[model samples]
Target: MPTVTWSRLNEDRRAAVVAAAEAEFAAHGFSQGSLNVIARRAGVAKGSLFQYFADKRDLYAHITDVGSQRVRCYMEDQIRVLDPTRPFFAFLTDLLDVWVAYFAEHPRERSLHAAASFEVDTDTRVSVRAVIHRHYLEVLRPLVRDARGRGDLRPDADTDALLSLLLMILPHLALAPYVRGMDPVLGLDELSPDQPALVVRRYVAVLAAAFAPQPLTTATPGGAQSHG
Candidate 1:
């Protein structure tokens, strides 16, 4: 939490501090992030940063909250518009498209997020895990239940496991090429407009085959007709 002094600062000053902190933390994660650099960037003396935030940890929490809130807003918009009636693959694929769009639009935040994943403090890591877990429980779990009610999933499918698998793989797939130099999921790190999406769809198709229930077949009084 920011101190009263931080709250009392004019909007421009507050923005400067946060923007500078965000850039520094994004570049080097918490351990390596430099408060001196942030102060320099924000045009404030080193002593002044303490008036706003108690320490680096406090400032980091604020920056992370800002980032998570923005991401949550994007997710809220997407989840509201998703149709449960669509096949799981179709729906998940669309959701991935939205995710890719989110990253693309907020490219400045990419290193911020990657730093959180690879080199953050224990507290930050725990909080991020909680946030992601909550997002899936609140937004994604319902989608799986809706699909089950509509018979899109197997009668005995473990909704928890299915959602977990998705939560694990989707983000990795999105970051594969960048995170792993020789990733099995290729083209994601390439700067092409379409390559990332193509990678998502291609892998999603393979995973969906395992998760999708049998295709529905319509039946007349005399016999069954496949629904193409």
Candidate 2:
């Protein structure tokens, strides 16, 4: 067999390392995973891991970056195919569809992310956590702002508040299956990848209705005392 040089390793090996690392992290979380085991699983030496990454945190960050980029690309691709004139709820539905696809296609990455969320390392946790948090904010902030500009959203709607609600709601919906009996009606865990889109679509419709701009109606003369 020809010798494998430091730079001669194919992309397959690199992908293997990432995949193995994701599984390791998902199984053990950040603080508990063993680099030695990871290296062995990746068919590399413990020292070779350092050749590819400075440390465990670096590897974890790289995983986060890769996963985030994949999700961003999926969202962008979906958005590009959408009609810009469509209502904002259509865009939200597309967004959820992309997420459902991602979770189904990359379940291990999702598990890794779920594990990372509870990490105890202040610095590493905060850094990686920020990447995921910022990803959602970066996408939603502009979308919400544009919707408001187009009169698709309520005039008094708080973009930040809406972003926060979406950030909280999407993940909960996405991860409900993994949450252990939290959503019996959804039973996300039991549903296959093909099934999530429909469930998520209905969920987004409810949110869209709640956030949709409503026509102002004149108050009744004897309407209950207004707070403002």
Candidate 3:
């Protein structure tokens, strides 16, 4: 959390500090990010950063918290406008699209997110996961429950289990395109521009099958449809 001194800073100064810290942390993970560089970029003395945050870790945590909140709010806003009655798989794809769009519009946040995944300390990582899990339980639980009621999921499906599955893979769906080595077959360098979309469609199809009441006659792009 920022100290009272941070709130006293003018809006522009606050923005500059956050922007500089975001860029630094995005380029280098927390372990390697430099407060000196952040202060320099923000046009504040290095000593003054301590006035805003207790320490380097505090600054990093603050940046991550802000970035995560922005993503959650953006997702909620997009989900609010979506038609809840859309076909289950199509609806999931649209939600994923919202994530892709958010990252596209906020590349710095995206990079910071990636860096945080690799480098956050155990406590911070646990805290981040808890926040995400709460959001999933709040926003996604109702959707899956409704899907089951509509027969989109198997009669015996466990809503919490399905939600957990989605939660596990959701980060991959959002970040795979931006990260190297995310695809097993493609390894580090084979992620062509189109391959990312193809991978996403395949994931959607697999998820649809995992929870569907029956085998799908038609699957999303890059997925094989069942034929009898």
Candidate 4:
């Protein structure tokens, strides 16, 4: 949360602080981000940052909130392109492609977001994770409803379950660079962006299989139900 002092700063000064902080957090993550460097980059005295933010934790929360707002804007743009008439797998694949591509097109933004997944302080993580999760569900509902109505998904499909799975996979879209840095031997980090896209395409197949309706059968009059 930004303090009243932070909100009262002139827009230029405000942007300077925000930009400097974003760069630091993007480059080094929260635990490693340097207040001293942030203040110097903003051309403010180190103590001035405390005036706008209670501490590093507050600053991280503000940054995470701003990131979520950016994600909201991106998803708003994406909602227009969603089409229930498209094949469900194709639509889903394209949608995820656009999501991963958004961050791909902006490396700094991607890094800032990926920062959230790292060693986070527990106090901030709970609230921050909840806010982003709420946004994910908000953006998912209408498109899912439309898909169901258009017969792209089964009527019994659990939107919650599906969304949970999708959101879990969505973070992995940004994990390539992080994974590469953490341990190159794991091999997932070595893939080109297109390779992950193909892997996720296979995941879409699994999701489609999971959501597809099962055939209903009845016991034959003469005998027993066959397990095979």
Candidate 5:
């Protein structure tokens, strides 16, 4: 085994505590989760947790920050190498694939996000929304603009609207498996591993078809100068 430094071990312990707190909150929600239980599960003393985080709310915020960074890093690593000249749908397909893979591997992180959504404070909601929006828009708006400039999307298409649509769709798709258990109408459990990609492809295809620039067509023969 590789030797670890004391600082590295401390960082690992802090991460463990955060992960344990996330799991506890995900299982019981913020109001009911116990810090002592989290510390025990993380194999760190309760005082160590307090040393790292001032309170439950502070720890929860840190967990959310970590989760946000995890998702941002995942998307950045995948999208960084994408060919800018490809059709916008190609990039979207890659995005959907990355999202599916990430959610599959980090179901607990997804659960933590879902649990955090139920917190009662308006300020907390606003802060979380700002963080999410900043991360998404920083990466997504430029891609949307590039697609429009390349004639893959209509020039009139609103980047913010498209981004919002994608944001709405991805989480719904990611959580569909669990949602289907509560309401069979969702039918997400019916999807195989490949189905997420297929579904995203179809959705993007339809959107692109609707929004792609239309070339002007001239009237043929004796027709009165009609245009498409």
Candidate 6:
């Protein structure tokens, strides 16, 4: 958490400090991130950083918190314009497109998120992971409920389990292009402009198949009727 002195700083100064910290941690993970470099980049004295935060860990935590908020805000903005009446799979494809756009444009924030997700300290990692998971679930729960209600998804499906699979795979879809070795088959080095769209479409196809409504069959004189 930041001190009152941090609040007293001008908005531009605060923004500079946050930007510097994000860049530093994005370039080097928490363990190797340098306060001196951050101070130099932000044009503030190293001691002034201590006045703003208690320690390196505190600053790191605050920066990650800021990044998470930015991610949520970006998603909220996308949600406002997206069509709510679209079918579940169509809506989901658009939702994933938003993820790809956000991560692609904000590489620094993505790196900060990755750092927190893979934090070395067990306590920090768990705490950050909880917040990330909560945000993801909050965004997804409604979509899953709506899909089930609309009979686009199986009513018997476990919401939590379905969300867990989405949490595991969807976010990584955005990273495939940016991260080295993450897209071995896609060969992002020479990727076409439409390659990302192709990736998302294929992934959504698999999800649609996996989550399709279960068939309801009734007995007939000579056959079973499928009400799938």
Q: Pick the candidate with the highest lDDT.
A: 6
Name the candidate, 1 or 3, with the larger TM-score value.
3
lDDT of 4 by residue, 1-228 (tens): 789999999999988888898899888887788999999999999999999988777787787778778877876778566764576667888888777677777777778767777746776566456666767777777767777777777778987788889778777765663456643542456766467577667778889888755555567668866432
TM-score per model over all chains: 0.74, 0.74, 0.76, 0.79, 0.76, 0.82
Q: What would you estimate as the lDDT of candidate 2?
A: 0.72
Order of the predicted models by lDDT, top scorer first? 6, 3, 4, 1, 2, 5
Alpha carbon lDDT at 214, candidate 4: 50
Query: What are the lDDT scores of the predictions, listed in order?
Result: 0.73, 0.72, 0.75, 0.75, 0.70, 0.79
lDDT of 3 at 16: 97
* Cα lDDT of model 1 by residue, 3-63, tens digit: 9999899999888988998899888886678989999999999999888878766777677
Query: Which of 3 and 5 is ahead in TM-score?
Result: 3
Residue 134 local lDDT, model 3: 66
RMSD of each: 4.2, 5.7, 6.2, 4.1, 5.2, 2.8
Roughly what TM-score does model 3 have, to 2 decimal places?
A: 0.76
Model 3 residue 33 CA deviation (Å) reads: 1.1
Q: Write the per-residue lDDT of candidate 6 for residues 1-228, one digit (tens) a residue.
A: 789999999999999999998898888876678889999999999999999998776787788778878898888778767865578888878888878878889888778777765578776666556667777788778878888888888777676777888988765765667777666775554567777777888888887777876567777777857564
User: What does candidate 2's lDDT look like per residue over 1-228, in tens digits?
Assistant: 112342467889888887777778888886677888888898888888777776667777777777777777777677777754568887778777677666656777667667667677787787677778878787778778888888888777766777888887767655664556646676565766566776777777776666778756555568844332
Backbone clash pairs for candidate 1 read none
lDDT of 1: 0.73
Model 5: per-residue Cα lDDT over 1-228, one tens digit each: 112331356677767877787789888766567888998999988877656655555566666777778888877888877665688887788777777777778878678666655556665555555656667688788888888888888878766778888777766656664444532443456866666677777778777766777667888788866567
Q: Which candidate would rank higher by lDDT, 1 or 2?
A: 1
Pairs of residues clashing in candidate 2:
none
Q: Which rank order by TM-score, best down to worst? A: 6, 4, 3, 5, 2, 1
Best by TM-score: 6
